[model samples]
Target: MEAESRTFADAEVNRSLTPEDKIRFLRDMYRIRRFEQTALKAYNAGKMGGFLHLYTGQEAVAVATLSLLGPHDHIVTAYRDHGHALAVGMGMNECMAEFFGKATGCSKGKGGSMHLFAVEKRYWGGHGIVAGQTPLGLGIAYALKYKGIPGCCLCFLGDGAVNQGVYHESLNLASLFSLPVIYIIENNGYSMGTSLARSSAFRQLLAQRAEGYNICWDQASGENIYEVRAKTQAAMERAREESRPTVLEIATYRYYGHSVADANARKYRTPEEIEHYKTYHDPLLLWQKRLVDEGLLTGEQAEAIDLGARAEADAAMKFADESPFPTEADICADVYSEVDEPAGDAPRGTHFFN
Candidate 1:
């Protein structure tokens, strides 16, 4: 197919990726993979509370894309966001602590797995509600435009969120106001357990909808980290420099259930599909293959990277286990933004709370 060839040509492995860069990419992706593996262990052991959504299969999308952002940029995504948070530079100890509901968490142990927020990191974090982060990302883009900042907002959502009303509404307004934002749909085959085929009425590529609002559109194979990085770079340029809005649909897959609990992924899709993906379609494995084929890495070196990640995650687990949990009286404390008053007569938090 000519179209397929063209897409491949666009992603022809970047010559600029130094040996160090290649090593780093492998390291980061492996880190997330190991982190999730450890988190699953903790979840089963009852160390982590609330629902756990593992970004097990989607590590490449988060790491490759966030590597393109700068300090001024902003980003938000859906609930399956632990990988995204770390990709944006959130520390491993805090992330694991957050998973364990420790007070040292990025969300101060309150947000749990689905809601990890770190303003200092420029990561707005994962929202629990479907399609909820769309308008919020748009608002962040609006603020960047208003402040005359050189930043863009990358809003990551699932295939399911595209069908929601707020998705369309924000897309329309972003195009109208020329918000510097790129809306990325991580089309991981299913919306929870439901396949995209059942829910999506759009017969063609989801990016086709962009034409109606005068926005640019693109697609990348989310299964390939290099392709994701290349395509996202072009879209990021159009948004950050030209003040254009774009919609990018990436075809990725989730390895685990929708949340950790959706053990019936096999009911919707065959076990063969899962096995094939892990063998050939996995982003990490695929990249490892590429690196070896190109003589950028040895099989032994690749295994070492995996071992390092697992060891690092084990250390972070110790940190989380030692961290403190929030107290009963601390419930209403962190609701809104305010510095702790200097031993004033008035109560601690806000006008309403104080």
Candidate 2:
């Protein structure tokens, strides 16, 4: 497939964003920021446990791409998925409760930091295995294509996952079958502790690899919400109308460490490098600046959004604390598939069980 001529710089920005849209974008970013900040605090306070992947800096990509997709469209992503869930309309309280391992969680507290799911909203899960969700995402797209559904599947993977064999295989199948799937490479430039340079011999031209599979491809600066929204809209449109696979390489950065426990303390990259990226390419701040410069939002309005997000996150934490944990019986319930016993698998007098 050929690379799309439309680059991120060519993406339309001024026209697509209304005042209300700008405000909503800011609010969404604030919500993600506040939620992750609270999650970090909870982790330190020993309330929330497990590997917490904070999506502090990548809010633009989440908000932008999610806004372009329809409710019926499905999303499957890697472990870094809290932003994806929230962007897809998962309730903050439910997400917090899930993080807290309460029954009120989106996954009934079964899936902690990396297993959030909302089937009704078509948000599949936060699969923990690196690149494991690629095949599953392609399968979902295949099913959608088979059913003649008008929805596309957006599969998100880290930069590291591109090196996985499943990634290439899934891309090949998706392209060959003309499946309605968009493969998004969230290139935060690290695979856990290993930098992308050290991990992959091919380095960082993700769209080029997608081209080898005959899939339409594009790259976007994930720091800019407008660029993300525009590029994703184009790719999604192609997928829906043409029933073809597309790839979007989002060059993003993570503000926090790979996981909450890391605290970004280990020195793989220089402090100067991290600071440079954070200062220049901070997604939330970029959007905030745009909104303010365009006269769509004032500093006061932005502060209010931040304050509101913090309060909302605090309320969610309280709700999760008050909520009960899942019962032991519920454990055997969601993990297994309930199907009738085949043939004489079950005794004649006993009913089938999962």
Candidate 3:
């Protein structure tokens, strides 16, 4: 028999969450929103370098999903990863500094915008290549299972990445080895400049293709944090308890272009369509409204939270500005394992230019 559908009511009625917890979620989401806004401002002013893939509208997905991670759980994602980085507890200063290519960045000014990493926090770096993180996520899961740790690796990819051959290979290996991995396809309708209908070959939900690999699959609206938590929790449990893999597709949207470089972002889609999502389907607004309706939050308090987030973002940008850049000798560092010191004269490579 077909399983029953999960209904996510307007309020989502999550009684397990304390009032404080709910408010914190709201704050976290706003922090991401504000951080993205600040990054965009900096990018426009030519203060930062590299391709910045902003996480403006999809805050709820990263915030909610990452909030569910346990001690053993790990996460990896694509270039649009600022929200996930923040959600996983990386400081705004370090993240913003990474964009500015400062020495204080999470990757120490070496990895720039698309390569935020916090291994200590169990968050693998965001890969710039499409579907590149999929196999790495599988490797993490395989290690977890091999080590007898009841953990799962949350691998996030965009809709565009679903077409990659390596992604399917990773899925096959995940199912074959029963790796505890949850592949989250953040289906934001348009992959780069192409719409989902124009690019993908799907009979129904994109996640339904999981059936071919004999893995459990599901899709849900990414607008609601509660809904995201509910569905992700189920997949987490399956991974922990059964050591099974799942393919979860979260229907999300990005307000900015594919990257900061995509000039045709607004041209591909009509302004009215973007306005509709912004006005009605904005995750932050929807969550705030729900909290207010439940008497858990006041309108003034929400406004204050938003202001606080903006201030925090501004402060982070300032920190990034004041921080120093990596030294010239630090170029060949982190390339080879034997190169112990970052300021070492040279590595074992004969092709070293310096």
Candidate 4:
């Protein structure tokens, strides 16, 4: 079956979500959409630095999946992470400030664009390297299990990252130890410029590979928030209760290229293909229509929510514009632990070479 033809009608709605919760989901999704739009605008106008991976078309995946997290649950994802960051409750001001390379960023301006991090929020990072965070995610789950924490970790990676050797290694370890981690492959159909079929060796679904490692696997549509939540919540429960790992592949898409740097985005894929996804499978439009259908929201309310999100994004951009840069003196500030500092107690030697 085609990726676009995936059925969402049969997916059950999460009944626990109140009318207010459903409205908040719409608002949160709109917030991510507007933020990505603002970031694209800034990048196109040369106001932002570094590679900008706009999460324009995959808002539902992040918003719905992260919504299931408990206080002890954690998350980590790849560089195309703006949507995930916002869904996890990171402020737009700090995220936008990171895009502007200002000191107020989550990484304090040291890690721009692809390295958004907030340990306090249990959002580990926005790792730049492909598949690099898999091991880290595995380790986090292992630690949680070791400490007897009743939580799990959601480790997200793109289709491109799944081919990396490190990811497979992480998979093996997760199953062997019964670690509570969910490996979500956000298969956007393309890896950089290469399409998934051409890049990876997969028979049916990518997540099916979990069978080899004796791990649970499932696939769902990223276009529907209800489906996303229903599928992910099951995996989270499995992890939390049984301490088992899962591999979930959500069929999603990206409107932009792999990054703003890829000029051949439109060339690689037909314009019609992009138009179809935008028209039929757009998460924001679909969710808005669903809420309206359920009598939980009206068209006017949805429009107002979008307008509010846009306004918030614009304000964040303005704040980023005014925020200070990291000073020269800040270079070595976060590099070393207090015990590793020159005047500290640790007997350190040959730590730095310059």
Pairs of residues at least 3 apart in sequence or in different chains that clash in candidate 2 = 1-214
Q: Give the clashing residue pairs of candidate 4, or none.
A: none
- What is residue 118's positional error in candidate 4, in angstroms? 1.0
Q: What are the lDDT figures for the candidates, one per model?
A: 0.86, 0.86, 0.90, 0.90
For model 2, residues 185-229, the per-residue Cα lDDT tens digits are: 999988888998788776358667887899989898888776788
Give the clashing pairs for model 3: none
Candidate with more favorable, higher lDDT: 1 or 3:
3
Q: By summed lDDT, which 10 consecutive residues of candidate 3 come out lowest?
A: 1-10
How good is model 1 by TM-score? 0.93
Q: Over the stretch 1-354, how does candidate 1's per-residue lDDT look in tens digits?
A: 447534653564444568788778888899999998998998999998778888887888998888778778889998999999888878788899999999988888889989998898889988999999999999999999999998899999999898899999999999999999999988888998899889887858877787888889999887776678888888888888899988999988888889888878669988889888888779888778778987889999999999999998999899999989999767777654443443455455445534
Tens-place lDDT per residue, model 4, 254-336, is 99998999888888899899999999989889888888988989899999999999999999999998999999877767887
> Each prediction's TM-score against the native?
0.93, 0.91, 0.94, 0.94
Where does model 1 exceed 4 Å of error?
A: 1-13, 338-354
**What is the Cα-based lDDT of residue 225 in candidate 4?**
81
